[model samples]
Target chain A: MMTRTFLVALIGLSMGSFGWADNPNKPDDNTTPPSAETSVSPLPTITGGLVFNSTFTPGTQSYSPVVNPIVLVPLGNRFLFESEYNVNSDLTRDHGAWNPRQLNREIEYMQLDYMVNPHLTIVVGRVFTPFGIYIERYHPEWIRDLQVAPIIFGISHQQSMGAELRGAVHLNSKVDLTYTGFYAFNSTINYFTGDRGLGGRTSLFFPEKGVEAGFSYNRRLGDNRFNLYAFDGTWNMKSIPLDLRTEVFKTGMLGNGYWVEGAYRLNKHSHNSFLRKSQVVLRGEQYFTPSAADMAMTSMSGMMMGDNFLPDQNTTRGFAGWNYWVSDAVKLSFAFGRSFALGENQNIYSLGITYRFATGGSEK
Target chain B: MKSTLAIAFLTSLLMAVPAAAGNPSKTPHSHEIDGEAAYKANCTRCHIAIHTYSARSERTMISHMRVRANLTKDEADAIFQYMAGEQKPKAAPTHTAKGAAIP
Candidate 1:
């Protein structure tokens, strides 16, 4: 079944590309004069590409493959349409619960973006929540040192139906304010309820001499509201033997919860040759959540509880991971850690490969 | 509908109240919560402060450590309050006047 669907999509893409390149002007444009076609503007074009990911879990001897192909259709100079479908194979038998094993299931993201101006724009539809770097771009081969994400940010927060406005207002060569405001409907599958949410965020950066610091915040309101506050600082020195970039962030979740992370790339630039991609990424983190007496009672009973009614439990964890990039589009990563009283000792490893192609419009 | 609207308005007001005073640059510190001692007693078993070095995003850092530490949201807030006190302001660097350097 999946194979037939893939073939159909592949044929549609081939035919669409052929039509786009052959005519340059599409047949659907009514504005084009039936008699004087020369004066008519060109019709939008559609371009497509593919992304395939295969992973091998050494411990379990399991193999999982995911393919996410994208089709981009230009609406005009100021607008474009994007559609991507992610299909994957099963890996549940080998791994425990929470395994990302959606076999041939297709999840999609479609977006309509209007360029309000050069520095600002509005996007609506199935949108990516721009909470952090990884959540925004968690495709195969894009992120290094991957473990779906930590519970604080990764599991609890995600993308959904929404609209967002974002832009960077430059003050000078070295200073700019980047801002985004968004609203989303609760995800039926991932969220606690089907309520709607709204959030706004802003950041400031100085990028001229390799020193950058920024602050960001997001407040999501729905049936259960979640809020985040963050501060980030990074420095890059290119004159050293190897290019180096180091960054640190302090973030808070909910009303009072917070955590900190720091990363340093020592050999970031020396990989001019085949071995140059072997930069070292070292990172560490500490986070804890205390258990409330009410939560203890609720857990003890194992019954349904409201969001604000659960007893809070305290937990903390620390982990380290490494990424070895074999090429610009391929990498191998591994991370291991032990949590305190939670008893969630686990190790994760992943290998990924990617390829990218461009056609009429800019890459999403 | 009226009640729902009232509840939403009240919740929005509550959420707004925290943001006004919680800006990191605007506010320097948080008061200590009672859960700090409970966190140290229970969470130190596996999670420690040095764990912050292992993550790139603050959300990832906290979420990853939260599971291991067996912490709840309120408990997590308490520990965060403790860490807020530990945060040190970056010291101004001592500088010697350089002849050719531009200010």
Candidate 2:
């Protein structure tokens, strides 16, 4: 009986929304023709992509499809709500409660953003970790240069359930500065929540020069009061279609990591040619452990967590790849990578194709 | 009878907020949202199909889409800058795909 009542309410509610939606004065001006000036879409947006990944390590093998869908909703003019879920499913048979079955499955982020000012905005709820450029900016499969996430990418504070203040300032005509300061804690036993922590990033960018550099730090609270710091930068050449990006990470007194990467477009001067979309990339990374004991602890803990961001032990990794643009929205990528660690040698082969859809912005 | 059905329909439509993709004005007419990078990140998913509109016209038409696509002041600025010249104030091409792709 209660179910029937609820259904009636739902039906009534849906009918009301459609009624308002049909009002003639409600600005359903579908008659206006498309024009040249860029328009801001007030309508909510829905976008998602898929990933197929297989990895072979010394002790195990894995296969999975990474499908994540994200949404951004605006409430009124000052308040906005956004959320993303990583519905990853493991196809491997050796699936454990957390490993092949529950590996990295959860609502990645769900937050509300308030614009305090042009240079200051506040976010509340779960947010992307800002410890380094990679986690927050390039973690998306479609945006990422390589199919495989870097070993050190998810090292600390992937998400925080609290509050944050982030914005940018223009220093001058050529230089600009941006900052992100946030405090988060895991208030629930759900997936993707982090420990009690405070973290942020501050960067200086040269808009005209196409160059930027910055620093980030995090202080994880509670029993383990460890610190994580990183410095990152990017340089886009003015004369050619070549660019370089780098990031270095430091944790506690012992943990350290760094990666330097570069990409060059086969053609940049022309827009109509498909060859112009082809690009080549190369990268090198290194992570150092203070002692052998720490390396063991990292490896064991990583496996138990099902997110083994750290290698079996302290290691150095080199990567090379190719990115071909099937179109403006779809990209085909292949990567060949190698890892040098303490126990033995490791090889990684990654391939992925990402398709992105957009209605008003980010699409051309 | 027609009026009764209209009332019932409107009420139900209001309840189905999921279908409402509220169109927002870009400038002048409607109150502006900062439009931070966070908002742009979500916009990228479906912004694959690009549409061109004059800034003046866009500002005039605050789309009453029931779908909630929020924009911050920074994000709004970024979109404005993008539409103004299809360029951004600053860029990290090496790190991000630059030139014409939405931020």
Q: TM-score of B chain for each model?
A: 0.35, 0.35
lDDT, residue A177, model 1:
47
Error at B74, model 2, angstroms: 6.4
lDDT of 2 by residue, A264-348 (tens): 7776555545556677889999877645654444434432222435554578999998887766567788788888987667787
Question: Tens digits of per-residue lDDT for model 1 on B2-93?
Answer: 32343344334323322332232322222222434523332322211121211112222232223212222233344433333343111111
The alpha-carbon deviation from the true structure for residue B30 of candidate 2, after best TM-score superposition, in angstroms, is 19
True contacts kept of 2: 0.05
TM-score for each model: 0.52, 0.69
Model number with the top lDDT: 2
lDDT of each: 0.37, 0.55
Give the alpha carbon lDDT tens digit for every residue of B58-91 in model 2.
2221221111222323344445544445443232
RMSD from true fold, candidate 1 = 19.1
Cα DockQ of the candidate 1 complex: 0.02
The clash numbers for all candidates, in the given order, read 40, 58
Residue B73 lDDT in candidate 2: 37
Candidate 1's residue-wise lDDT over A1-364, tens digit each?
Answer: 3223333433443343322221226443111123221222223332222333333333343445555555444454345455555666756545444566556654455667554332334567765555543333222233323432443443224455766555444344345445555556655663222235444444554434444444444554554444455554444332441222222223232212333333333343443443233333434444443235423432332222111121133335455555444433344555544444454444444444433322333211
